[model samples]
Target: MADATKNPIADLSESEQLELSKFIESEQQKVKLQQAIHQFTSTCWPKCIGNIGNKLDKSEEQCLQNCVERFLDCNFHIIKSLESTRK
Candidate 1:
C-alpha cells in the first residue's frame, strides 16, 4: 500500500520517481556547492591573508576573488572538455 507520505520511493509512479530523483539531485548539488565554498575559503584565505586586519584591503580582496574565480574557471573548462570528449 503506497501511502502518499510513506511511498518508500519504490512505490512511486515513474514520473514521481523521476521528480524525486531530480529533487535529490538538486539538493546534492547545493551541498556540493557549499563544500566548494568552504574549500575555497580555507584554501584562499590563508594564502591571501596573513594578519588579522580591521578590514580586508584591496589586494586581499582581489586575491581572494581571483583565487576563487580561477578555480571555478578551471573546473568549468575541465567539465566542458569532458563533455566534448564524451560527445
Candidate 2:
C-alpha cells in the first residue's frame, strides 16, 4: 500500500488528483474501520461465547453485545484521556 501522506497523484491533472486523493482517503477509512471491527469481533467472540454451539443463545448474544459496548466505551475513555493529557 502507498503511504497516504505522500502525493501519489502528482503527475495527474488537478481534478484527477483531487478525485484520487478523496478515493484514497475514503478507502483508508474503510480499511481502518474493517480492521477495528475484526479486532473487536476476535477479542469478544471467545470471551462472550463459552460453549461452541452452532448458534448463539440469548445469554451468549447479550454477552457479545455487552462486550462490544464495553470495548467501545473503553476506546472512547482512552481517547478522552489522551486528549486531556495533550492539553
What is the per-residue lDDT of model 1 for residues 1-87, given as tens digits with 9 covering 90 to 100? 546676477768999999999999999999999999998999899899978889999999999999999989998999999999999
**lDDT tens per residue, model 2, 1-87:** 868798656779999988988999999999999998997889899898888979999999999899999999999999999999999
Off by over 4 Å in 2: 1-8
lDDT of each: 0.92, 0.91
Kindly report which residue pairs in candidate 1 clash with one another.
Answer: none
Candidate 2 lands at a TM-score of 0.81
lDDT for predicted candidate 2 compared with the true structure = 0.91
Misplaced by over 4 Å in model 1 are: 1-7, 10-23
Query: Highest lDDT, which number?
Result: 1
Q: In angstroms, how far off is 87's CA in candidate 1?
A: 2.2
Alpha-carbon RMSD, each predicted model: 4.3, 5.1
The TM-scores, one per candidate, come to 0.67, 0.81
